[model samples]
Target chain A: MSDTQTTVEPVRMGRKATQPLLIVNDLVKTFGNGVKAVDGVSFTISPGETVGLVGESGCGKSTTAKLLLRTLDPDSGEVKFGGQDLLGMRGRALRRLRSRFQIVPQNPQTSLNPRLPVRSSIEFNLRAHGVPKPERVERIAEVLEQVGLPGAYGDRFPHELSGGQLQRAAIARAISTRPELVICDEAVSALDKSIQAQILNLLAEFQKELGMAYLFISHDLSVVEHISDQVLVMYLGRIVEDGTGSQLWNRPGHPYTEALLSAAPGAERERIVLVGDPPSPANPPSGCTFHTRCPIAIEACSTKRPLLKPTAGGSHAACIRTTDLQQP
Target chain B: MTVEAQAELVIDAAGETSDAVLSVRDLTTTFTAGGQRIEALRGIDLDLYPGRVSVLLGESGSGKSVTARSILRLYGASAIIGGSAVFEGRDLVGLNEKEMQPIRGSGIALVPQDPTGSLDPVRRVGAQIVEVLRLHGVVDSKKEAQARAEELLGLVGLPDPVRAARSFPHEMSGGMKQRVAIAIAICCNPTLLIADEPTTALDVTVQAQILDLFVELTSSIGSAMLMITHDVGVAKDLADHVSVMYAGRIVEQGATSTVLDDPVHPYTKALLAAVPTPDVPRGNLIPIIGQPPVSGMTLPGCSFAPRCPVAQSSCTELVPELVSVELGHSVACPVATEFGAA
Candidate 1:
């Protein structure tokens, strides 16, 4: 199928026509031991748009997600949500804005309380936001049905439910409060192929129906390509490449992005195997963090860091040889 | 590199009929949990041909891992195992623990899924491999075992084998630990190797490299491989033969190309369609409705009937045997049998 044919037109929610819903600039987060988990990242998520964050392990994808949610404080950054300063919000302000942002974690089995029934789990969040008991009950059933789970499933414990069912319940809870933007961190990675498809379809359906945005973080490229409007490729805690899904998939300018795309199965492309492992984030290489593993690395790559610049394919790539690289 | 070369390799090692180094027939395993008998494996039959890769593909709780554990006799004492696993004219199922001692490692090696859990955290990587080599009598002296351990590490594509051997399990990455596990598995050069989801914990790039390493190592050692995984892409990339298992039974088995390209079984077809390929558009995923039958639950006929889209009344009434519709291709669904023949 063609990329354009598969693309789902974003349904505009009840927001200002032109203003972006969320805007982040120069976000930086460093750990206790001097590990730059998220370093100098910036992106914008418009209403109802799915922005995919792709990277391997230790590339700060999860850290970036946490930073965006304010679960981890950023060293320096400006986060504006709905024309309001999100990073500057505190106390009652942050709690009130909590309902507008929700996160769906990777493993639903661990995320849900084993002792609590699915109903109570969904109700807990709504009750925390001061929703009435009757409204919470009505919303619980509606959200459960929306996630393709039966109403009776609310009475069942997490251990009694299947992996797929438990994940559906978790999604139900995330959307129970009607969050405008949901952060899915490796949400469908733990599921089987069949169940993964079901979950992906559910996510897309909810996005269209509710007119919500998603910051989908996953290492799986195919899933990202299917769901994302814009894609960001991170390497060693830095955004190395950024473009629309079709633009990035069809023409990857960065060497790291090229290798990652080639490694994914079912793509009819030549495999470009890198020579060595990724360098540790704690001791990343000087010039280009990816210079140690880049297939087309030169002497300059080890000395001078390349900044993200506009490439030929209407994408931004942090590679000095972006112009010299062949189109994928 | 070519089809001709693969064909030549297949013929050079063993002729078609005598290619099976290990043949499992009517293999059944039962476990008692909370005083309830669970039929984990229900009369499974499989063949592992020498120098060829055979994949057992299934979803979780589909008995793919149980089949691997049963072949190695890794179940507890309460578990009852019934069947014959014949390897080189010997029935492994009939052999006791004392009798199966030598066959465990030297005859058949295992590459487990979780590398961190499988390796010794306290011991250096090289010492663990050396222990396996010396225990299997693959080498004579300690010095020789150490040399062989580093050599095996190098063979598995570890860039600095010496450094990797000196490092502990905690010091290495997931992919690095897996490479070390592969080195330990092939240290003895057994006739058969069982890798259970060896690359599931790794990244795509690492997984591809490990898959290549498996093919290379197995081919060089002329060892038959029985790999278990839930990913169809891994099977398509690695398997010479593919067997689709569901609810503890082999629903379909055939040559990898034939089965993947033209699947006859409904379950296999659904599985292939469910994977989110790069070419497939969003919202077009054909997800299989409902989940697999829970463990210990007895179904009258086809276990997949409740979820099968085209299941007939007869499918719920009678269990179908694995009948062949074409040469080397078998299916356990009556409706698929009729449709495939047509």
Candidate 2:
């Protein structure tokens, strides 16, 4: 299914917008120290659909992003992008596929080059994809305008801009190539609330116009639920729950999801304060990793590992007592 | 005795000295850098009662950190402080370093913003706690200090206190490092605790646990807390009283439910509207246009006038003063005050 074209279009072409843009099956990554960071993770994203990956620190959300981005070589997995095998591609074939996928990292200050102008940074991506120099300048201008940044901002260095402006520049650079999928790995986590809202709105607006699917990864559940069409809860290197935003928000099936919702500030429901820290990834529990801190955990939870089973809430949860724990 | 007697006269002159553990009046902080004077904290008034949590809520560059640092006298020589921080019948602003040494940890403890930055990377976690105990004379013998350190570690909810005590800062997680920081801060059990976004670095679940720990430890010791955060939800969950700051000034201050539920100031209302809650549907999130004014920028009138939605012509002419709408509730917006009066 791999298509290598010498002339790359600025927009996604030929694929039906409703079809799956990216698909992953049984992705697994174990580090040097025997820590299974991303263990048997599998999900799919359609064109223009946002899938939020929410989890605590060291819960493999970031590692999953890295694996999908092909920055880290996974131990075992299959990643298909635009009906092409992303894992098997190498050399120029992989490089050509890269223009169809992009990333906006967490810190724009570090992601953006300090020495170069903002326009040049965006131009670098287009140039790498073999775009002509004249076309690169025009595309940079178009993206900067789309992101609501002033045209003069293109000539300014990153240090001259504020955090919000730098993030805008980062977004401009990411969309300059008109990638079908953009992985925002905690993109808005560093900014203040108001700035965060502005960036979120911008991303949503661009997705509407460009029809780009987003893999929005963040530890902030509220932000995730706000922007995501589907949300996945990860814990101890495994996906514990997967459902629609409203489904996960209203009737969280997994104990870990319930605890996360309860722990969020201003949650109307009674707070369920989980005890102790998450176990080390390298030394994760045998049966169920989250059973140690699950509020309604039983003897079976410690003895038998639970698979992703459909719960009463219409969401898939990896828990033995999801039905019993769901509130009316 | 003379300082106490002088403090009595000052307190009476300040009027209506309630049972506040820390009473701040007209607290202003200025920094001089590159021959430029920048006002970090404009004139402010606050009253923190024992066993209650008062949160200073604002966006970045709104002077929340400056307020906490000014109280602790943590700034360098460039900072020109003008205010009164009265704690335990003594003014802290005028006290010299030698005089402030005993009061810093034993009288009022500080939980800094970053636990990783505050903790000693090279030393064991237990040694750091024990050093604080010894420095403040909390315990006499080294062995006793070590035991107390372990006890404090357990109090902060470290699962294996002995193992955690022996572990280095690098050996622990972000949550564990923060717990160690909290353990050291409460080692002396001061009357006032200043925590600057203590849970901002941790995960949401871990943040919930740490916030609960703060409440439990402070109330048990009857210590008033001044928490600084940019999150309105955090203030809502933890604060008994909340102060909404904008452009180096307190635009509103009231009980948490009162201010957050029925915010009068346009800036406070805008900030709340900007937050992305779980209930708020996608595409409904309101983005406050324009950036917060850079710190130290000289604005003639209301600093937030340019961004405030309800700002009128007069808002740019005169700086709004805090008007008491009701008991323990105040707002600095003229339009909001007028509406309340009507």
Give one digit per residue, the lDDT tens place, for model 2 in B1-342: 222233344567663454778888889999988888899999988877788899999988999999998988888576989988888778888988889889988888899878999999999999999999999888999999999999999999998899999999999889889999989988998889999989898888989989988889878988999999998888998998899999889999888988999888888888999888877766678988888888778788999999888888999999899887866688998998897643
For model 2, what is the error of residue B52's alpha carbon versus the real structure, in angstroms, after optimal superposition? 0.9
Candidate 1 clashing pairs, residues 3+ apart or interchain: none
TM-scores for all candidates: the values are 0.94, 0.95
Please, what's the RMSD in Å of model 1? Answer: 4.1
What is candidate 1's lDDT per residue for A1-328, written digit by digit as tens? 0111122333355555456677877788889888988777877778888889999988999999888788989999888887789999988898888889899999999999999999999999999888899999999999999999989999999999999999999999999999989999999999988889899999998887888899999999888888888898999888999887888888887988888888875456787777667777888898988888877888999998787777788778889988877674
Docking class of 1: medium
> Evaluated with DockQ, which candidate comes out highest?
2
Give the lDDT of residue A46 in candidate 1. Answer: 81
Listed in order, the DockQ scores are 0.59, 0.67
Q: List each model's interface RMSD.
A: 1.5, 1.2
Q: How high is the lDDT of residue A4 in model 1?
A: 17
For model 2, the stretches where C-alpha displacement exceeds 4 angstroms are: A1-17, B1-18
Q: Flag clash pairs in model 2.
A: none
Ten-residue segment with the worst summed lDDT in candidate 1 chain A? Answer: A1-10
Candidate 1, residues B126-154: lDDT per residue as tens digits?
A: 99999999988889999999999999899
